[model samples]
Target chain A: MGHVDHNTAREQLETIRTLMDRASTYRRALAPAMTAVGLIGTLAGLAAPFVIRDNARSFAFYWLAVGLAGACTAFLLMRRQAFAAGEPFWTPPARRVASALMPALFAGTAVVGPLVNIHQEGAMIAVALPPLWLVLYGCSVHSAGFFMPRGMRLFGWGFVIAGLLSALAAANPHQIEPSIRMAHTVMTATFGGGHLAYGLYLHWTEKKPTA
Target chain B: MNPEPFPHLDRVIHEKARLAIISSLSATPSLTYTDLRNLLVMTDGNLTSHLRILQEAGLVALSKSTGETRPQTTYTLTDIGRNAFTQYLGHLEQIVAQFRKTTPSA
Candidate 1:
């Protein structure tokens, strides 16, 4: 006879592994759609100047204003999600970074975005946001790994990867980059909507059993 | 013929080593690797191996830090793990009480 009773321990461990697998599956499915959205947002934010104004100087100021506003929208939206769980997602260090980094990043980047039409700095900073987020997401997970659901931990890591790609794509363009805007689509799809999708799938459906 | 659910938590917990680790950590919030090994009266390898298994299962996580001086490692349980452990203890108590009541010698 075997010395160890592997059956019970194996079954319990399997349950957790199952949850993480489902979460990863859900995010992978959603990633492309999100990338598309961010691309669209970037294009829209980029094109807003052509719609409202044409000259470089006027466009820069107007684009900066709108970018600031869009970034503001993103911040507020993130805050709502963070607060909804009674501040569950924001670890103390994460909160500290987000408080200082988000506003400063967005505000600074908005000024830079329209400038991207004429200058490379805007694209550089935009590129930085997603990866910076990725590093932050990893730390957040590794720190809260204990209390978080298995699904949530995987989700955190996924966003980190997605964020890095988005940042890389965003920062590379010299003038009016379409790819980073697409990156936003990717980020939103994977991190924002992808999270909601994973939650909904687990909440609404019973997972099929696996051996 | 008889059929009922098997025990939720059995005498497995009354074992001194596992119980000490679970109960002590429950009060302390989080514990370092050394702290756990010391409390459970286990050797370093014994605790490390168990903690690794727990972490891989997502029941626990270990953190490593390297500051100016040396490295540090710590472990803590996740929400699901904590809940399950708590419920297991409660269910075990109930089972014990039920058996105590029905025993013929009592």
Candidate 2:
């Protein structure tokens, strides 16, 4: 037998080990759950102008409903996927993802109280809300994406860009109504549309006979 | 010039299959028997033999759960196994580093 170079052998072993570890992680199954979140966001965005119709309180409640539903969907779907894969929901990779996600989400949640307080005091904080939420959410997803597939990072960047644009458009005092509509539209496109696209991509690319 | 002194490599982990198993187990929290077999692309008999050897050596732990319709067997690296693998890699790196220091470039 040919003698194996210790360095080359070590490198090969490391590569194999990394590939095996990645394969063992839960990736593909998250697609459907993300898609569900996106769909709910899209529906909320479409209904916002009609249902809330310039009532900031209703708008806040509408989005809160959507957020709660999306969170539930994500949790249930992820748990199901983990169970189906015969892996624990609290695996090392899952914990890493949550660790990356939680900080940004918590920061966003902290901002919500102050934003709502400002809105109740009748300052036009509504215009700033969506963009801030989107940016933070994007950051959360982007960081968590490090533990997931390579393509997920792009979605995070997409949200950040969408958020910045939303902020810029809301800068005009006379354009508050338009900006609200635009924000909802952007939320629908990024969260709802982005998730559906990601899910579909995963389904097509990652579908294979499980070992 | 004389070749550098070789580092001691753990023979138990020197085998490719066992090394692969240990490396995989070290990375993940735990792996089912089927998952490990598929990852290594080893036959049932071959994998079982290797796993048995590692178990006997106190390097691996096998847990069987009977909650499912069929009992599920999962494997995890024992602390001893983890230390052994770390030590083995350290030795391999030292050997490589020494070889590079002594050998002339092509």
Candidate 3:
């Protein structure tokens, strides 16, 4: 028999270890938290029309409240999941996810200030902001999927596609009302429905197998 | 063939099991004993032996704390260990690169 190749063995072992590390998803990504954020998004979308009826100015603040609530929900749930897992919320994996996601989020937030001002001036620029927000959010989520599960990337892509469509609709002068409704529907489906679906999937699949 | 392509390979960290253990610990800030065992898929005794060797070599540090119900043991790579691992990986990469350069193509 040929002698065993230590170098080849070492390389194989290293490859396996690397794969395992990459495959290990961040358990603290909290599906339930995502679902909560989705619920909040749905509620906000439902309330947006009534709250901002005939007043475009209130649109910004209403969505801002939704964003804040979603952020808080995600943060609290992540903290809880981390503690339960006997790890810190800001672990190496979590930090990687955040690092990947932050640039897009910062860009979105930065653009919002200008967009809100334009909207206050009664310009159509404000109409396009929501989809822009979605596109940015989708980019962030897609980047974050690198450090998360395989399915997350698909979710991210869904947001991106929806964002593009919404933006297209918003750009059409004749399609403003339908476009606004479409944006809300997309928001509800992506944030609300997406979260619930993914959360339930995680809860079912990730639960420890009983002996 | 070169007489010694990897003269500086740290023998203590070169073993397969020990390398795996060190590599795993290096990726995280700290890992519990159970976490390591499950990750490496090694028996308690096998893992303990490797951990002991690394611990003795000052390549890994163990911290023990009482959880709400029981004591927990976690392992972290020491700064020295981190440097050593990085150096070892560099050497391995060099070796692989050299091998690829010299080997005839099929």
Candidate 4:
């Protein structure tokens, strides 16, 4: 038993608070991944019209494939970063990020099935997919943002708002025609352009990783 | 001087390094040895010693896995540890309250 003073107790309490925050905080080395994803997205957007043309199903599959590729690229980049840092790839925070992302991404993929089935409104469906996917992707990112940097949450919200605005534009035939090309443009602008801009911003602001 | 003025304070968790270890573990589900070391900026010998002490006291648990490169060690707070920490926090709050009660207004 020792004589503990009020000041000592308060200092210990502060130590606990600080340590808890340090332990839980996750710093994601996101610049490279975002840049790579942005490049992939931008390229995919450019190629979509030429490759897929007006076939609604083809358009859907093409973008899905692009999304998958982008996701795989991001995962590999992150894994590489973890390796460089001499840390495990699947840490607690990584698990938390994955868990948070799963539901919304799952919903986005699931919705594509029913959407592609509507044959009569094929053009409308094609146009609709981008916005729906955007919102869902936004939601997934936003959910995962809890375990990531604060900027990530803002990025997620950007996706969500873009999706909503895209949806609104799609609904109004006067504002923008509902076509596969238009859909491609929208995806290109948001997924492609948005990621590139953010990637550039991160590159400028974030500390460069040591070689 | 009063003997054991703060009776509820956990001596095992009272040390600076040990308290820091416990607090870090309390926030997350688990942390690797490297992660904990990096967060606390403690030497390998110091962290190993403190972790050993906490483990002996049934306040922490460790796991080892053979990863791609080497054997990685991870640590987490035990049920006893979590309960102890919660009680420790309650005691600290009480101490602060007691101090406020005795002191006159500024």
Candidate 5:
């Protein structure tokens, strides 16, 4: 039988191993940023009715705007793999739901307030907006047999935990108090910092260019 | 360690392809079905048959997951697989070492 080059074969095996590990790490780092914004948007959605209990429709509308945006972002990133190249295309677009988007939507909605003449129950509907959007976003991102390292799974579990806790608090009067922030922090760290750490660890050990 | 006077490759651990698979798994956390498929580059029926052999021999482990889209399978070396691969390397090293002492290379 022809002989095998044991030494060279071993080296090739090691090099490939490093590359796969690094790719997984890079995937981890970006996952959290995408998830956190969507998560907060969802929470804000669920909280809208309770916060602005009197104007349910207005609240629902605002939440709906945020939630829809999150779902769209998830669709662009996860489903289509549009920006998977890790270049400028990979960077997530400006989040309209959380910081500027919410205020802008609120202002726009308020301006239209007299025209629509939204009552209190109409305002309560705003709270459901983010959750509804988030549900859609989650659905869009959900896929089977997609490759994910253990780190991604950890981040996902964090989100589920956050959502459940937030729901429990939302059921009570003091839903907005402490647990929400904790969930946000945990989710951010687990997905953002967690992914970056995973990436760096893999990069340091890896022999090839994983990015 | 010295090379055994009667050194024969262990059947379960000695085959080159299976050895290559275990060696690859030892270093990576896991390899996907497609990744291993492309790496081995054997026909589906052939790879499946070999993998089944290794799996039955308890030198490899396999798992399957159903993602929202499709089912993905992954492979990893078992603890025994790692030990066997390592021992194979060590055995090769001893053979070279013995050869070097008994007869210097030209």
Candidate 6:
């Protein structure tokens, strides 16, 4: 058997600790996924008002479809990246991220049905859906931030703050009237513009692993 | 006097490269060959030899999948490997604690 000294043992433990941290770190390149989602969101937001008009039900369905599309696009991009890196798409860390994001995202989608059904009487509630969606989406991202890179939490906070501010503006009678168009505008500013800004930032700041 | 913890350590995982590999695998579900190489900054031959040693000891499992262009291989620690790592950590902590006991604080 190989003899080990105390100094050697301590050094080995420290090395193990570092290797563990590096192995668990999230290394996936997010720029592509973020940019793709950003483009989709911006385009969807711009086209929403023209296509859906004043019908609250149509508005709800349109945004839901857009959200679904954005999510699918991100998923596909991530899968492609995993393959390119010679890694599996559904690793344990990936599972952890999905688990974290699922609850808030599910709530955001589930509430849409009831909110649209009551749209005839509680039109304000329907108008408020954009902020609600923003908060829920922010919370989802924030929860999933544990398994992601550092900036994700801040990005999540941006959505949360935007949602709260939109809610405040809606509540102020002196502010612009709460309408479906107003909702679309809010969504456009926060989801569309926010994603684009963050995506661009990531593209610029992303560090390439050296050869 | 404490019995030497050195003899108790898992020899297969006690070497520098093999220990690093085990440590990395323990942290995540699995890693691809390229991923491990990049993370450890190790050469192909060195990594392959260490991985083979672990695989032979049943401390690691390897899987190969046919991709569009080529075959991709991923490696994960076996249950025995995880258990050994946990025990190794416990023994290391005991050694550290024993050292602290012998050497009084300044």
Candidate 4's C-alpha lDDT? 0.85
User: What are the candidates' interface root-mean-square deviations?
Assistant: 16.2, 4.0, 5.4, 3.2, 8.1, 2.7
The digit string of per-residue lDDT tens for model 2 on A27-83 reads 546667877887888887887788775645555656767887998889888877656
Provide per-model DockQ scores. Answer: 0.03, 0.33, 0.24, 0.41, 0.03, 0.50
- Model 4, range B1-106, lDDT digits (tens) per residue? 2334488688999788999999999999888898788778899999999999999999999998776665778898999999999998887766766676678461
- Considering only chain A, what is the TM-score of each predicted structure? 0.38, 0.82, 0.81, 0.89, 0.36, 0.88
Best candidate, DockQ: 6
Instruction: State in Å the error of residue B86, model 6.
Output: 2.0
**CAPRI band of model 5?**
incorrect
| Interface C-alpha root-mean-square deviation of candidate 3 | 5.4
What lDDT score goes with residue A25 in model 5?
A: 29
- What TM value does chain B of candidate 5 have? 0.85
Candidate 3, residues A51-117: lDDT per residue as tens digits?
A: 6643334555566667778888898888776566554567777788888889988887787677766
From the highest DockQ down, the ranking of the candidates is: 6, 4, 2, 3, 5, 1
When candidate 4 is compared with the true two-chain complex, its DockQ is 0.41
Residue-level lDDT of model 3, residues B1-106, one tens digit each, is 3425466778888787898888888767887787677666789999999999999999999999775445678899999999998887776666666566677561
Question: Evaluated with lDDT, which candidate comes out highest?
Answer: 4
Runs of candidate 6 exceeding 4 Å displacement: A1-27, A84-87, A121-123, A207-211, B1-3, B10-17, B43-58, B61-63, B96-106
Better of 2 and 4 by DockQ: 4
Which one wins by DockQ: 5 or 6? 6
Supply the DockQ value of model 6: 0.50
True contacts kept of each: 0.00, 0.19, 0.04, 0.59, 0.00, 0.56
Candidate 3 ranges beyond 4 A from true positions: A1-25, A51-54, A121-127, A172-179, A207-211, B6-12, B41-46, B67-70, B104-106
Residue range A111-185, candidate 6, lDDT tens digits: 988888876544476578988999999999998887787799889988998999999988885768777778888
lDDT of 1 by residue, B67-93 (tens): 233454766667855875677555444
TM-scores of the models, in the order given: 0.32, 0.82, 0.80, 0.77, 0.36, 0.81
lDDT of 2: 0.74
How many Å off is the CA of B31 in candidate 4?
Answer: 2.5
Instruction: Give the DockQ-based CAPRI class for model 3.
Output: acceptable
